[model samples]
Target: MAHLKAVQGSKAPATPPSRPLGLPGLAALALLLAGLGWLAGMVSLVQAALLLVGSGLGVVLYHAAFGFTSGWRRMIVERRGRGLRAQMLLLAVAVVLFFPPLASGTLFGHPVQGFVSPIGVSVVAGAFMFGLGMQLGGGCASGTLFTAGGGNARMVITLVFFIIGSVLATIHFDWWMSLPALAPVSLPETMGSANGIFLSLALFGVIALATLWLEKRRHGSVEASGGVLPSDRSRWLRGPWPLLLGALALALLNFATLALAGRPWGITSAFALWGAKGAAMIGFDPGSWAYWQDAGRAASLKEGIDHDVTSVMNIGIVLGAMVAASLAGRFAPNFRIPLRSVAAAVIGGLLLGYGARIAFGCNIGAYFSGIASGSLHGWVWMVFAFAGNMLGVRLRPFFFRAPYRPAVKGC
Candidate 1:
């Protein structure tokens, strides 16, 4: 719908008014949110607020980094500007946050806890596939959740199929594990987490410089856009610094989450847990479900808090996103779903669920948190999923329409 905007001098332009939600709808939303908060044991109003705000901040951080990535992809590749320098700046921030001990002898809490070190072939292959998948899916795992919460019907479809793909992958986990792997590529024996971080920084620097130089020399040889949407410039403030700082804050929040929970950042595990719970309620043995088929290897859903953590965290994410959408006046209801698209969503969700199990994390857990923790496998999953995303994008026309037009030009 049209929104009114005041301009200089002329008669105030009339615009279509937004349909405010009715009292009943608002009441229902409040009740539902209240029930969710209760179930999650957010006993105090303050705790509830903190959870909502923290998770919302996390989502915002995610989008900010995403925005920067999209812009850099355009500017550097288009030879329009020095996007590489911008990326380097962000990476520099990541380095300081991830490895402060190099200069000060202390990283995030428990310096020993964050040191997973690097590996070889597994990481390389996983990174390639992960990148491809994320591109095709139109978003990474966490991205799917945020978009779906924002009422993007197409994202809902993509999420369904992501679950399907992940679940299917779980069904074949033995085969995947049997695939070639590098056991212990510890950095301590070679260079250590701090040293490895520096090495990575150096390598990224070389690549960034080369990319920018090539783009400038080639005169806009690479395509200006990829699977990502253009930016919403108005959504961005006067400068990009706020968004950049927001990302660093997100990384710090993630560190806190890890410290508090004694675990790493993740989202898909929550999805799987919810799926399992739903299955059990419907008379199915969740233990027999493909997604939970690997539970025997970890902790059984019946025996551990995995399902609880998943359910609570997933709800928090949805609620957090909902709150943000509402405050930003971006909330709406448009749940029209074509049969074919429904099928795609279900299939995709199932796959995404299973694959996350097999890979041990989705985008955030495996790719972001994992990489930040120095896990070689984290990098592997990222590369492979990205590859999967790339392939998934090609199949987009068959599954759903892409609707991510943003406000920034040439981004």
Candidate 2:
């Protein structure tokens, strides 16, 4: 009742069709899930559950066309704050939910930790570079995976180099961490929950208002987000979910992750780990690197990749998006690549990899999860990254087509 009323009151963009699930896609997804469960079950039931959660994440991300890169780009270029505003809403919800448990220090007897980190040179530089890369590479960490899984050939290129760059950065990760940085500060830890939550909400509101003002000044009116199209059924299976709903779904999912996993959601660590494993295949001993020398990390390195929580979830996200795209009849692979776009993908991907590695996360790990965990470094990340995006938007035209077109065109 409440959700329906909110939908009626709000304005979001018209969504693409919610088609029925194709039989082949459904069968494949089921088989894949079964296989993943089998693999993870070899480890533990908890691992299997995380795989399912990861799949749900991928489905929600694909069905919603949720793009962190696009969201920031739209706000910067078009002054359309709808996407960015939705992010703010997501953060608002996440913080409110996350703070209570994080402050308490334990949930269901499991020790829980937030993503608090220091504000320093490494983070500042990494985040700014990541912002630039988001435009150049065409997606953030999550965006790259989902788009690639959904059969964007160019993103496959991005994913490959993203791994290479991540591996390369491991060489200098020690130096970056050694640089001067403020102590890790959590808003909830430094300030009581009452003060932290209220202050965070106020900041969100202020940012939202500022965007509205800028949008109005630039475009003469605040743009309307056309709501999603109504459907008799099949909305979940075939989706173009409204951005707001996507935001809410993500927030709730993150909270669930915290509860289930005993930590906030993270992504890029898996990328770096995957890259390291790939290096080992060719006789490169990334295991000797300082970064992997930690007792816990070394043990994880020895275990198969699937044994790692983030790696398993990352795999789930890839497969889940593929299934979602296929179910929607939107899974069309395009191999044709322009030299200019490929150039962008290479450069952007390297930046994404290195930037994320050095910064301790990408948009998903450092920015989204960071902020939601009440880390001051998360807020610091946004400021520098946004600055990077300011310049990246300019360079984009030289490297890629001016705008994106759907695979089928008018699909």
Candidate 3:
């Protein structure tokens, strides 16, 4: 909660001025380029491109301060809907860009697919845990990467624990999968593509309108919808981008990912892979686990991190955030974390990693990509995750002595 408060309190300048780039930022940029070159040379060009795409995502996320955790928290605690509305807009735009291509089963001559997973007990329980973890951890998967890249020392701790939890979950993954689950349901497949797209858009509109009503009822007027773009060139280069712009950029980038990768964007799988690889190094046989017995999972486990798309993208996000933070002159890492906060990070990180594994993905993988892909499971994940967030907000006080104050910024 303190980390979230810090993020909310630090508003980017309205008219950002040109400033000297930090040494760290320069160094990060150099590293990013080198990473890309290595990937291009050692792996396929597509992998390298994916890294670049991930970096672009990190930049957009950091500049906009786009966050699913803070957005939901603000909506729950403060009756603010700006962040939630931006999310709705993001989903709506993604539906438009993705539906037709997914229906056709290809993008730009490449086979493509959406993130459609089963709706079941695992998703319900996992999403709920993920929601609670977001509050305690102060960030979601994407949020953790960008904030950690921006030099938040506490988040690094969360990331480490997150990896540990992910690996731990794999040990129990077989049992979770054995639980009751519905068949994967794709709206575009069940309904017609046009019909599914329309339905999804209508749902987004309804949510956005609901947020508008709630905000208006709670506070005499609703907050301004952040649809207008700033005219300043400097602001674009060093941003606090409008939430809508951030939303649009994210949607477009996701579409790019689908085109290039033949699948939707995802984040947490890399955590599991990293953990499994680490386990293997210490004489643990993750490859023998039922979760990794699958051909694809087994192959990824054996191959190095550089060959893993999610891993490369995850790294790109961190480096990209570092570059952005340095450019913004905000890459200051504070290591003086409270003991209680560290405890929260550990518990929250564990919950997040385990939850994401069981649930089939995190906010990005399950909720965002899932819903955009017209999967019924995505909707189920949202409802349960929101319920978890409600409880997580209540649990926040137990972890922190600081008085609860609403964040001023949208996610």
Candidate 4:
């Protein structure tokens, strides 16, 4: 996670020099509570709860600096495997938490389901594009939201273009869906729940082991896996949390999402919805688009953004990060951006938006939630997306002067 700033081409310190309870943090906390109260009253208690979950995720993401883009970049460029290994550990834990409930077809008496998408040419191509885009945009979907929320001006630019790109993709969504595809495949259903869980853990173990081997070969030793344990309880609130703890927290939260929402955690669908709504405001008839013609999608469009679960969660993520950044005394926004970097943001955002739409999700929805749900497409997404990252890392030289390197060695 130390490499997060580096991957974003930022010059800011990885950790703020001071931790203070700022006025901005207090305001953010108050606003969060007010929003929760409003949602509970106007929307539903479930929506309010989801907003709270998203806020928690934002805190964890910002404080821990857990990011997929930087993790993959570090592995690809520096051969540092700590971030990649942390991801594998996260997946392993999630698989354990998810499989049993999914197999039973319910959690706490509510029907629950995983993000099982079809494996197809669209998924392959879209995931690769998304991976490449995240590298250029300097953040993945969740990374963009949290960083933008934390006051990274360049990422805000990336986020705007991401919305635009997602809207554009809907125009061509029908064409993409026409590509060769298979029915959704769930590993638990195919291989049995226990067997599927075992296979997933084994794969995660193999990947973690491979990263350890590669990192040791390159650096002559493996990097330590997590942050130093907090010296005091206060440090836990104002943190640089241990990476493994962040991983575990994410797994548990995602499981909570499944239990509460009846589906796993997701991110980019909200982007598309936002874009479509904007288009409608501008007198563009997005409702006619093939993507919006689906019964569920059409219903969402009619319901307005407040009624959309993903949109509310997405909003909470931004607000939550704002609070965390304020608490860390790191919520300074610098708008000065290089011409090339801005250009990269525009292009990268478009790619990320478009790719996520066609691919069914981004790192969170597809790769993380997907694999955790024991879906075959999730594994396929990982392969293509990593390939995209390889190409994206090479393209960085065009926009960035040099890859930012921190004083700290490991991610």
| Residue 98 local lDDT, model 3 | 91
How many clashing residue pairs are found in candidate 3?
Answer: 0
How far residue 361's Cα lies from its native spot in candidate 3, in Å, is 0.4
Compute each candidate's TM-score over C-alphas: 0.67, 0.91, 0.95, 0.95
Count of backbone clashes, every candidate in sequence: 69, 6, 0, 0
lDDT preference between candidates 1 and 2, better one: 2
lDDT of 4 by residue, 47-84 (tens): 99999999989888887788788889899998988888
- Over 4 Å off in model 3, which ranges? 1-17, 403-411
- lDDT tens digits by residue: candidate 2, 1-411: 011100111222344454555664676588667856687658887778777778778877777777677767878888878778878988999999988888889878888988888889999999998898888887888878877777677788988888888888887889899999998889888897778899999999999999899899998998665454424356576566667777788788887788778888888888788888888898999889988987877888888877888887877778787888776666656676788888988998899999988887888788888988889889989999999988999887687454642221101
lDDT (Cα, tens digit) per residue for candidate 3, span 12-67: 44544556778888888998999999999999899999999999999888888888
Where does candidate 4 clash, by residue pair? none
Instruction: Give the C-alpha lDDT of model 3.
Output: 0.85
Flag regions of model 1 displaced more than 4 Å: 1-54, 58-92, 99-132, 184-190, 214-243, 288-300, 303-311, 336-351, 393-411
Q: How do the candidates rank by TM-score, highest first? A: 3, 4, 2, 1
lDDT of 2 at 88: 90
lDDT of 2: 0.78
Q: Write down the RMSD of all candidates, one decimal each.
A: 7.4, 5.2, 2.4, 2.4
Query: Judged by TM-score relative to the true structure, which candidate is superior, 2 or 3?
Result: 3
Per-residue accuracy of model 1 over 1-411 as CA lDDT, tens digit each = 111111111121222223344443354357446754674563444334434534554345323433222333344234533433443444445444554443333445443244342344434544444444443334556666655554455566776666555545544555656666666443323466578688757755785677667775778554332222224454332112234444455566665555444444567665555445455678876565444555543364674332354444555555544444443344454466555555555654554556665666766666566656556666566446645644554554675554322111111
- lDDT computed for candidate 1: 0.48
